[model samples]
Target: MLLPVRHSSCVLSIQFRAHSRFATTRTITTLASSAFAEIISRSSSKHQIYQSISSDPFVNLSIEQYLLQKTPEDSNVLFLYVNRPCVVVGRNQNPWLETNLKALQKHDTDIPRSGSSVRNVLYVRRHSGGGSVFHDEGNLNYSVICPRDVFTRDRHAEMVARALQKIGAVNAMVNERHDIVLAQQPKEFAKQKDATGIEDPFEESTPQALKVSGSAFKLTRNRALHHGTCLLDSPNINNLGAFLRSPARPYIHAKGVSSVRSPVGNVSAGLVSSAEPFSMQRTILSIMDEFSRLYGSGHEVRDCASRLNMTKSEFNAGDDWVAGAVGEVQLHEIPEIQNTFEMMKSTDFKFLQTPEFTFSTFTTEEDPRLRPPLPSFLPPLTRISIRAKKGIILEASISTSNDEAIAQKQALHSSEILADRTLHEIDAQAWRQIIDSIVGIDYDGQQQQQQPMEEVVDHLTEFLCEKFGV
Candidate 1:
């Protein structure tokens, strides 16, 4: 839609120029200049300016080139946030090993963010394998592109967190309006500084705090990732989105979470002493439960309402789903909502590298100058998209070898979420094949499945090795 408008404007301007060619040179120059100025001011509104300067196309552009060419004089700590608004895994993850490959792929983009964001896109991958989730603009995308020093672990991302806190505080204030104010009268902005300024003692005292800065410890009572862009000193001109759809952090949007929740709220302060991925805890339990029942024992994909007492229609799961190996064993059928489930295998893919690029600008009088008639590319900036989907795993494997041992191992390890057994319980072959598949070894493999159940890891990896020879 946007591309067409840009083209049409270009055509109209060209036609306007062609007609001007027949006029007197003085009149033609005057008209031409007017048109040029109008075009230069294409982004006439602040909102439009935000859209053009801070959305997808900018982020897609090479970060290095964008950074290098940024205006050196404008030194307010520039930040850019990029959110993948789809299903994103951790830095080290195995899609198959950690999630229901078939089910997750089909999980619909029921909720969407602004612009060209798509469903089921994997944005992050971690060493620990798990699941991907859905993310959108409502999730709060923030970035801080200041000097490299600003991003000092807790020091860097802290800015983004505090901003979210400020926003959340405002939201909370609105939620508790009657309490904040005894009557319905307005109160003045507080004398205290926001999260950042309060911590800075050296700065001179100020009665007013920037509205952008949020207050402290305003935890989101509801579930949802406080998301947005974060950039340091660099003028990070890019998309501010991060899909809040990791299994560790699932999208509660569908479950009706529309407010910001502090990251600290979801985590126990005691646990933060030796922080670990929170999703793995429950997810691992789910996996273990499934495996314990997977041996065709007492497993069945019973409706969720029958087990967890969840609202049947909550996940649209007519009933919340749970199963073991017995009556109704499930290998994860795609949900009916999003047809993409077929394409949405329990696949895990993410980009591991903090992709870097280079950009430069000089103060010379000639070309590539600080001021420009228009923001044109210099030497040109390029964008690179890196894809990743690998993870270290435990007690896993996959294979076409349906020997009794393999079947038994598969049954044993892949039981329902509570069947509970150690990885050592299964043999090396089953561990390698089934567990490996769960860990995402054969992710992009276009497996040759018949009409029904598809094969798992062992063969998929073999196929990939032969296809790419890596």
Candidate 2:
């Protein structure tokens, strides 16, 4: 369950840029112009790295896409960011089937002040092909964009695994699925045994590997983008299931990919030593170092560092790299980034992009699984079925257990009201009003039955709201 919490709604305006073993501070406008120019310029550095200061999911993702498209074709780029709490589904996945929209709504609220905007949780559809993922401040997102020829599914995943190992997580390894997982040592292997009889704890026979990172990819004719989420020290790990599990899943038969559930564990949980507290910053730095080792030129390294203030030694002890500037507010000034950001936040992109699916109150030919029983508050034989494409209702029908002709007519009217409407466009209040009008209609002047119908309508409205997240 997600609880309502207040968050800031301001956008960050400051920026910083770093060079080899030195730091230079610049204004937002200057940094955005230079950084934007450098990012898209083909003559720019071959190995580029960036760390996003903003926690906004929309802003961070928009920046990522911009880098994927605008960066030099042959350049190998690494972008690292942490987003505020959000559920991000794949490009073709259905949010209503992958996420608990009703629970997400509990965290939605408006905050008027401004400096850096914040929201408790958001629902996003990313431009990648994979299952849904949950992100928050505690999770670090790493993206590597390179030429298509050099791209391999396990390349960056292995890099991240090495970084995790460097930070004392020896159990971290890339699995055959190209995901980073922590191998669980069996109870028998936990104790010292005869050298001859000891079995490899991480052998293929072990069945309980806990996933710590999940990978997703997007490829173009020239560029390949690989990105993944690393669960470091998330406090909401236990609550992830509540957000990702959808009540509407059993009711919806969707066309796109569905998420594969895995037993997930935090990387911080399996650290070898507790002398130092786990930190996302440390994990990010380790990953950055690993990326640099793989792609950086021997002479020096450059990075678009966040706004955090740090000494030269804090960033790089040797004369290898320096931090620079780029802020979310400045990135928005770029036309391409602004357009992508707005599009990502729009309802059209969020819901209208969903693949075709059907929602039924009872099992149908297309969706043959037995459905959970409906609430007992309504008629036992009541049925509702809906078919949608690109989120628009193409067909709908509603019926009650009643055999009365008047009741049948009301059901038809209700169905007609729903047709052609987009699922996201209809709110709970709108559904209530539509249901009220049809149920309020005089049924052969039987005014005495209207009261009971009203009660039924109220229950039906609540049920629909929960099911559809209207």
Candidate 3:
């Protein structure tokens, strides 16, 4: 549906030189001498700006995809928005290996419960390849969508670094890996510059620098998108740490992008000025202006920067701009796009679509305190390995190498303990079914009634006992 026009008089057609070989004339409806005009310039190559009204992570991601697919070949696009608190995994990443499932379980427990319904932690996977990152209101996310001809990851990163610098981060710089880092100490800055010849203070070796932004990209035959998270005032860094920590399952092996752990700082920490601390709206406006300055044509910069200011509420409601000529803002309502969004939200698609990889579960060396005390009959330590494919157990083995005699004795003990190896397969299949069902439900537990953790654990134990004929 076309947006309702508020003021007919506000509509104006802006014309400029078209650069594309296929088109000689192009016109955009935008406010004269406004940011919208600059964004939709008649120039051969131009950019468009769209801000999502909803904060639903699923909806936001879907909107992103819609914009990318619908973008005009001659025009680039920019999206600025935040998502509800959730953990987004990269497309190729293994959910079991990249995230702390145990922590997620506890996280689910921490959510406030009402009646039989329980709020649950959300897990979203994106088409881009990057280590998992946490998202919330405090994290501002932006996406640069453009054709392959004009898409440059390094230039976009530099633009983001400049924008951060404009918002009170005087020392912000883009590192070799394209992360935005803040260098507080002179030594740290010097060490980083000398090492990589880049201004980044958060080089891999620089321990003092704190990363404020991390970027990733997705490319298509004709288009490309670079999106990233900017930490401004994350409410719970501890939750970020806990959820992003390596999984306790060490026996699993997969080829995936691993997150580079680094000290992170909130952009709000450096967002202060002589007059007052900068607000999120102000920060957003500053970034929009910078984006216009970098990507907009010379004929549009001054007018665009001067008029780029818009409050969060104004952007969300969009009564003024969408209907008028201030900008070309399109809210996606395509049924196909909506269906894709719903499919992506499903557990079957998210977990089962992953590349083939080995997953195992057993007591691993996680915390020293959690290690079981040494048994007198067995060696001081025993290592067990269980291999599985798509949740089906393939092999099981327990080993000890304290000494030859100890190894032989341990093998004998393992035979007794692992007498019913087939039981492991049956138990694994049952547990997989349970997890598959749980994840299929809505995160808030509204769509399905979830079994209590104690009940689930007891059920698994009972299944195992029956399998062993105990």
Candidate 4:
């Protein structure tokens, strides 16, 4: 109803006011974002907890290495996981020297030679330096990564022991060597736990003390990784013996690190004093809670419940697979991390990392699988000298005499398999004839190939038996 100019002026005024309000709102938002950025910059050293859901030992271990490598020097990370059955050896330790390869081969078959459905055991070598340790679903492994200056092995181990006690392992104590042991628990502890709805897994009558955990450490340029295994309620501990056997040969003189063997026990058998109750899920949560309380900042500690991610989507983008709650924990698996694991397990890669050493092959009599032991009257045979580099046998030679002969010397010198037939003479005539006959013996024109070194040895053993009339 007013003049055109007057109405236009009023409309312009309203528009200016609206724009001013919008500007003010944007300013406030900018200020809040700046403050949040400042807080993040100040606490860049915040501690983090990663709970992996993958049960594949290879995948879990690869993810651990990735996290340790990716974490900032100032930040601290705690990784927790349960791996399927596997044997993890130390970085510097020799696989053949530390474990029984033959026994391990038997464990690798999906179905045992006896046709049992027991799971195959996987072998892994960690970047840390320590003795070999067996891992299964019952074993809980924790790795703590932090700056070198902030790292305290004893304090970290004590932290684990205290958390263990909180979850009903009342008598859990860390030994000097950093192993957690259950000294002894009173029999009445079980009744108190049961009355209070707490779980005591081990039999009350079996009060024998056991080893609960073993730890190892690796210090890099600016950071340190402290990883250890905590035994939970593993059903099959008996299979541990099948893979962790004594050395194949006596007197292994190498500069490599050796494992100090000890009597190990499981945490399930440990003593629990609290009526608060116990469970694997509770134990895992408690350990993380204690870690956050001890190391995390005030807000960080309080927000742990929300920050803890148990889904694949939470950990990695584009990962939709969900590893549902096993027991009480909802686990997550990221397939992208598997590339690293596959690389780590590759034959050429792992084998090339082995240190150089002189090795002696096991004789027929020393073989555990053989029945009706070979007669001692047979010549001092089956003793072979091998010089290997990175686990690959570079030089091999047969030793007829009981005394140790160098591989180079034996290969150069003529050796006698029998009383009169020298190796040099046999190679010129008998060996050539055997090779020709073997080449001619093709299976349906599949083409006969050169026999493998191990099989060649077997053929030689049989040839000797025939020549000596054994």
Candidate 5:
């Protein structure tokens, strides 16, 4: 486990050893408090830039929140980070409706790497409000914290567009939706210029644009935070849709935001060149240069521009404005950040923070959309509906066409048991037990009725387990 560091001049380091096959042993060295203090004190600086060396999503997000809350009102800050495989949902979004929880639970060892290991994809709820997004080592996340008075939805997005253009992604531009997309180069325009002998990157073309970056935000009384993801060269790009497409979407009526599907492309796709291979480090440097130009002081701006060709490590080491892992460790020392970090990783915040939603096997008065066909194993005319708030079942009902008195009584009992229970807490075994108790079992522990009712119970148990990922 990662531990918080205290203020001291001595070097603080820890070795994390994991016996599980999913993780590898590694040594983590944290910077002393003085280095962290210098970075934090720069809140008053006209322009500040920091990058996280840690890939833990929780740690990076916690640090981002700290900067947003602690930075001076007039200061402009830039934070860059890369998280390991994880699905991040908006603050008000429902995880069950936005992500494939079952897929996330399955160990993913298919990511192309030197030494691939089984890894569980994480689910995170961000502090900002927007659609859900996927993050990985190849995806670079940029966040800008600026005064609310001067903040606009598209200002930083436009800045990122300029950065992409500077790096030879000439078709990159900010779309009306505030997302950065690479306009498709029409076949006719592939080899020819426009009427003025110049191509407009922002011009709307015929084919659909390929989105490369998604933007989201959080606005405070004085500070406005705009953060976005830039896809570079993710190995799992082809598998992104599977993880974001929730199995419960058809049955769920959610009260929160839903992700708008888009055809995504990588920024590296536009960086083809015979002389130089695609480099994420170079792309990040370009973005940092643009940010510095827009907000850095004269000397700082020049310094950033001069380091464009330097490696990321060299740039971080030589630049006084850049803080790396040290800043990440010191962030945990702040009470507010520590609390926010713990809260964000807690079960209550992950599941209970979800907005009210309903799951119905059939159409209802309130949610009258056409329903999908139920499993054939379910009894004819069988219907199930559950209403939940903050992940706790508020009301539930189950019924079948059967009019037998015992069946009616069992249905009512099952519904009663479902009500007031937490959706995600019900494991497959527990759910099976609940169904068995209602349907009745013989002395030999076999289901009493091995026909319609037994099949119904089996189907419900499987459905709940798969949908909730318990």
Candidate 6:
């Protein structure tokens, strides 16, 4: 048994011996058992273990420590989303063959910067009622992570992909978090996917045409479903879990057998051909954009799924409405932040976009009650902006009360209210009062005001009525 690393907590895991011709599934099972055994034996938290694994200079010690120290709260559940920039040879795939690492090195640096990349995995509070995801951020990177025991690995990735599917992805499959693939799928898959896009209804098909830009993933869409393309069989759960829970170096080697085809296979070319699909992120944006068009950009969230062709029951609601899935969180820009809590603090113009209303359902075919994981690492609740230029960043959050997770899933396949306000487009008067309150130094952001607060609301209402006119 491998001993626990210093400063790190025990993480249970499963691995797929992806790069072998004769490698039986049993071997991977053995590996998974060992990984889980190591985790269970540790009797410590994953946070403790992660600290042992990471030593980044940019992160805060306490927060970093908090991230590494796994609590006794939940079992180590490896919820993996393969969004890696270069191919990540599964604990078994040969890196050289699977990834053109040297080529990706340049774009790898170009990948967008986010706080969670410090360790390159999403983390979730144990049994925290949800999981976390490592996002691709539009780059071709694999999203991989481990969480406390709330769901299985097979189910975890499927849950993520399925949620992604809700957004209309025709080829999104949870090939293990560590399981990496070419930047693009095989040729046949590309041809089929492309042809379907051109022929299908404008709203029903994915907008992207398939091209081999090194590599990318396939998302399964509803059309693909109608044509009968499925994930076939679940991969070795133990192997998948371990891969998500552990970093590659110490656990998996770079070299492997030439035949290391992934059992955590992607959607086949055949599948992509039949299932013309919209990407989860893309679908959410389309709906949002349309909502914006109907109500004006950044209006309140309502009847999004109804706008689509699917029925309401198909929405696949998890435990709660996953606001984080929307990727819509926002933050205020720097100059706008007053240095001295002054009566009037202003410097520039700006806006913030919250998350998409729906993505994937994080539960497995078995445990749909379990919610999809949260974003790999929760960002500083919202983004900060300047007057249309560069600026410092800040955080903001949505109360659970304001976001009904289950209701959203139900609404996906049918018609229901997702949110009362999109929180993107508020009335100019509301903006004025918020600015005034901040300027007048009377109220704090998001907090209710006393007598003047009512006045603030009235002006905001009137301003929206007069200005935004929604």
Q: Which candidate is the best by TM-score?
A: 2
What is the C-alpha local distance difference test score of each model?
0.23, 0.71, 0.55, 0.53, 0.71, 0.24
In the range 290-392, model 3's lDDT, one tens digit per residue, is: 7777765333432333344333212111211221111113223256457667877876556654553443334445322333333343223344444433333
- Model 6 Cα lDDT, one tens digit per residue, 3-91: 33222111122233566755433110111112322332244322111111112111111122222232233322111111222122222
Which candidate leads the pack in lDDT? 2
> Model 1, which residues run further than 4 Å from truth?
1-77, 80-84, 93-134, 154-470
Alpha-carbon runs more than 4 Å astray in model 2: 1-33, 105-119, 187-206, 273-275, 302-325, 404-411, 438-451
lDDT of 1 by residue, 314-429 (tens): 11010111111100001122122122222222222231121221111222222233422212221121111112112212222222322444444443434431123322123345
Order the candidate numbers by TM-score, best to worst: 2, 5, 3, 4, 1, 6
> What lDDT, from 0 to 1, does candidate 6 have?
0.24
Per-residue lDDT for 89-138 in model 4, tens only? 88787665566554443344343332343456766787788878888777
Task: After the best TM-score superposition of candidate 6, give how far the Cα of residue 223 lies from its true spot, in angstroms.
Answer: 37
Query: RMSD to the native, candidate 3?
Result: 11.7
- Ranked by TM-score, the better of candidates 5 and 6 is 5
Model 3 steric clash pairs: 19-44
The Cα RMSD in angstroms, rounded to one decimal, for candidate 5 relative to the true structure is 11.2
| Clash pairs (backbone) in predicted model 5 | none
Candidate 1, position 255, lDDT: 17
**How many steric clashes does model 6 contain?**
81
Regions of candidate 4 where Cα sits further than 4 Å from its true position? 1-45, 105-117, 185-209, 246-251, 276-278, 299-311, 315-339, 361-382, 401-470
RMSD of each: 27.1, 10.0, 11.7, 14.2, 11.2, 26.0
TM-score against native, each model:
0.27, 0.81, 0.65, 0.63, 0.80, 0.23
Off by over 4 Å in 3: 1-45, 105-119, 186-203, 272-274, 297-332, 359-429, 432-470
lDDT of 1: 0.23
Clashes of each: 93, 14, 1, 2, 0, 81
Worst 10 residues of 6 by lDDT: 322-331
